[model samples]
Target chain A: MDPSEVEFLAEKEVVKIIPNFSLDKIYLIGGDLGPFNPGLPVDVPVWLALNLKQRQKCRILPPEWMDVDKLEDVREMERKEESFTPPPSPYYMELTKLLLNHASDNIPKADEIRTLVKDIWDTRIAKLRLSADSFISQQEAHAKLDNLTLMEINTTRSFLLDSLNCMFKLRSNMQPGSGTGKALDY
Target chain B: MDSQSYLPVPPGVGMEENFLSLDDILLSHERLPSRTECLFPRLGYLEKTSDSQDIMEGTKMELPLWLAKGLYERKRRVVSVELPKVYREGWRTVFSADPTVVDLHKMGPYYYGLGSQMLHFDSPENPEIAQALLQTFIGRFRRTMDSSQNAYNEDTSALVDRLDCLERVLFRMGQSGLNSFQGWEKGRASHLTTSALVLNYRKRKMADLQA
Candidate 1:
């Protein structure tokens, strides 16, 4: 077999495997974006493409997985993202929506989130900074981790889930409102 | 009792003549001394005949209580006790007690006003007196310096230096007094003034030390 054909077949196999695996199970294999044959199989690239066929569906349907919008919409969307989102009880689709919107805007909600996390992280960092011996003990580490703010940790957890969902939704050829949703396994 | 008998007696007949001519009789006449003669023998005729004439020669002396107390207080040994009040009272009691000891012409203004003088300043003639005054001043200064808490650490060096300078000046004054002035009469005023100036400098130095 030709090396290029083998490579292409491997990529196809990886794409096939993406839908069967849950979002959490599908690792980002390589490159800045993800495991790729140029782009994800469905929603993300189609949503990203500027051409009319791709652009029209994105504008009309606005995939639940696609996050980016026009440059003018960026600031307003970022402001919405920063405004407080109360975590849903037992974590629901609405909480995922909030996290997806925040991550999609790509407007350093991480830094804002990090700042929010700082109060939780500060005592740990201070102890680390002061500790004469370089490494933190396991008990100290666990104590610090336990002390992390619920809202901050929750937001981070939701963001991770949203990212995984995007990867899954993109790879699996899932369209918006498609009811293949298996209870958002992990 | 007769008017004619009262006339001046014959040269040797009257009692006055008898008393003068009868010196031996008069000497024998006083078996007991006369009351007036015994009380004030110096004032009476006994002064003329007293064997030790020098004992009755000069004026009598008695000291009033205030003068005695003032002298006792103003004594050199007692000056430490007196000096504070003396300084406070403008050295008036000190001057009154020993006007000769401390020359008023030089030290007068510190105690009293300069009167009508154009240039009013302290005068000291003896350097010893000046040094004594300086010592007293430094003593008071040290007392104040010890009690005071303000900037004591910072002022310590400057205070010590100024005190040293004061001592040097006082010593110089003393040396000059000894070298130039012989009698208290010439230098008394200058000595007194110098002493007062030393005291004033000491006060200023003390205030600085306190600060």
Candidate 2:
């Protein structure tokens, strides 16, 4: 899938925003939005939050996990673990990029948070590659991808799947008649 | 990614060849060393080295893989296909020692495809040959994966120099995945873009006008 499409999915994640203008409770398809009062925080999807923040109609409250200290802890835990640790959020990478890019004014230590998140991402990708290599080398039939975020998986999906397919075909060549007789593989 | 009119058929890496795959077609054309088991009455023109009207029995000649495959039989050998030099014991040892060092592009560009096809002919070392083919791929896979994924927005001719045709396909897949993700990270993928088909169509019209 396209990275932009993944980003679009991330936009559905809700965030807290404080509006400067009062609006009567707006009802819509997904759910009721809110009676957004000036200086009062209301939960809204990232798409609407970014739109309101862009119009100078609201102040975006960065997610609780977006703090630099918390991310530093997550980064440390990620480096110490061999397997994937649960991510801060399913769309952490996308949310971090979007929020920091659009609402850095409200997010304290935005630059530091960006760097920490990037470090965590790099660490996770390295572990992912390492595990993939072992999985191929051992010729294992299946693997569970626990705690891997969509953005992370999207980066390596094509390469990993293609290699696995090639390896399977090459391995099947070992049996004299198996290559042709194995109609079930398709 | 470059715009293609249609998806090209992928090479079948094992014994069965894809009928429409361009790679498989070229692979079938690769010459194999063979010896005629019986005499040919009027097919002497095929043997350019001799002036005889009939090809003598046991006449050694090179035959394309398709022709060799058709004539070869177990019970009565009309023709005998020899193992290609690269798949013989000497090269098999080299591959077993370390597959990553050898240049498969210079060797059989269709290394995996042809190697699998070689299995059709009965030989004492058939098992060894198959083992070596699988091992060679397994040994060289890591380098192919790493180089393809890491080399972004740069000339990849050097990176792909030693890769076999099959490995090259894997490399291209890796590159596309990496390129798309990198483009999105730089905030470039969100913009509205013209389809590559439309852009190429414009170029085609310009070429027609010039002609």
Candidate 3:
């Protein structure tokens, strides 16, 4: 599997951690982590943070956009536009899922966050379906895409390519019948 | 919540693959062996039986699943040569206590589709073969997602490669009309879009910086 957008976001996303113990700098494959104080908050990638949270060794501070109202606003924008700017992180859904799965207690209004994310996802998916419908109907070789994600691209790729290839094959087949090629063969 | 446990199983096509075209199959590096040799010779008359007409004493023949099963039932052990080392290992792993990741692509989608067609014929004797492959595939897929989730601190290229491979597998699965990936669809889709957003943001940021 390719590195998902979520993975990219997760790598870049820094989480505030209140560690249970002080430790020297730890080196990870991607980068290095610093010496920690017991009470002091240090930044770490969301992936490491989630692992620590799961281990009950540290507390993770959720990102700014994780709030219910903000997510609702983003959802509203998504619903209004054919393709609008997405929320801050590509890893938003994955992060939400991970945090909710591993550290729900650490997040305030976890239930509300879940509901809002679900609503946004549904709305966006519906829009994507509509776009895909139009894309199919248009039957053009090319179409401008707005705010298309890798998921939507992956979903539509085979269908689009197959349809286009079929259309081209049909066209090529028909051209032989309509032209001098038939007469030459005869 | 393990969302997978709650997914509505999509309607399964019993013995047909309609999603992929012949061209797609041909283009892909998926092919059955040119010839498959039968290990166990005919007990009665190799030359006399109606079903054994295709069988020659020494030469290998690439028999279809139906013919192969008919021969097998009659005690002609058609040696299964098409199954790759990975699949054999995967099958063994499914039986073992700890099963590692199985590369479904290496097993090949067309090959899997072929095997699925013969499921009805093969299942009576070896009931677990097909089910184990399917279950292990799902498990591996779930693990792929989990790995992606945990890959934040990993190299970007490796992560991208994993995601790219995943997208391909997901596409093939879609072609098969298998609802198995339903559980991961929302998350996968969301992850893709999120990446697009990040790219767009980065591009805009670069433009601003240039300005």
Candidate 4:
């Protein structure tokens, strides 16, 4: 899966925005959104929020956990633990990128948050690679991918699956009669 | 994942060869050292070393794997296939000791494929050979995985130079995964790009047109 595809999925996640102009509650197929009032925050999908932000329609309220102090805590927890801890949000990486890229002005300590997220990402990726190596070396049939995000899985999916497939084929070769019988039948 | 102009039929990396696979076809052409258990009359031309009208019984010579496989049968025993040096005890020890050191491109490029195919012939060393192949793969896998996943946005020719064809395929798989993720992380995946098929497809040159 593409990261953009994952980001597109993430765009469906709801975020808070305060629109300057007043508008009545708008109904959509997904759900009812926004009885926008000046200085009053309303819940809307991230795609809509970004669009509104771009047009100078509203000020996006970064998610509760988007703050640097919280992220720094998350990073510390992530580094201390051997396995993954629960992420701040399922779409933390995507949301960080989208919010920072489009509306850095609204997000306080944007640079610090960016660096912390990157550090967290680098640590997680390193753990992911280490686990993948052990998985391959030990010849584990299946592994439970706890706390791994879709984007994280997407990066290693092809490589891991292909390696497993290759390993399976090579392992299957150990029993000569299995393939030999099939060969004679052919 | 990137799409190619054609979906290549992957090699039948087993004792059984896939008929349509180009790798299997090429593998079939690999020569095997063999000794004939029976005579081949008027087929001495097949053996350039012999001037006789008929190939004598018990004569030893090299034959392509396809020809050898066809001529060999356990019950009839028309020919006997010898284990390749790579599959013998000496090389097996070398492989088992450290698989990463040996450059597989210089050895059997189809090391695993050919090794699997070797089992078709009845030989005392079949079990050992099979074990060696599996062990070698398991041992070399970490290196292949590390290099494939880590070497991003760089010239990979050095990393790829030592890999066998099967490992090369796995390496490319890893590379594509890494590259796609890196591209996405760099915020380029959102941008529209031309399909590789369209990019590679173009009109022939004037020289070709004239020819």
In terms of DockQ, the best-performing candidate is 4
Model 1, position A144, has a per-residue lDDT of 31
- Write one digit per residue (lDDT tens) for candidate 2, span A1-186: 988999999999999999999999999999999899999999999999999999999999999999988899999999998899999999999999999989999999999999999999999988988888888878899999999999999988988988888788878878777854542232
Docking class of 2: medium
Decreasing TM-score order of the candidates: 2, 4, 3, 1
Docking class of 1: incorrect
lDDT, candidate 3, at A21: 81
True contacts kept of 2: 0.76
For the second chain, the TM-scores of the candidates in order are 0.16, 0.93, 0.40, 0.93
TM-score of chain A of each: 0.18, 0.95, 0.78, 0.97
TM-score to native of every candidate shown: 0.12, 0.94, 0.46, 0.94
Query: What is candidate 3's local distance difference test score?
Result: 0.50
Model 2 regions more than 4 Å off: A180-186, B202-211
Off by over 4 Å in 4: B201-211
Write one digit per residue (lDDT tens) for candidate 2, span B1-211.
4436568899988888898999999999999999999988999897899999999999999999988877877778889899999999999999999999999999999899999888878888888988999889888888988898899889999989989999999899888889988888888887878877676664448767889
User: What are the clashing pairs of model 4?
Assistant: none
Per-residue lDDT tens digits of candidate 3, residues B30-70? 33332334433563254344355354544444554434433
i-RMSD of model 1 (Å, 1 decimal)? 56.9
Instruction: Compose the digit string of candidate 4's lDDT tens values, residues B1-211.
Output: 4779788998888777878999889989988899999988998887889799888899999889998888878888888889888889999999989999999888888899898889889788888888888888888888998899899989999999999899998899889888987887788888899988888899889999999
lDDT of all predictions, in order shown? 0.26, 0.89, 0.50, 0.88
The TM-score of candidate 2 is 0.94
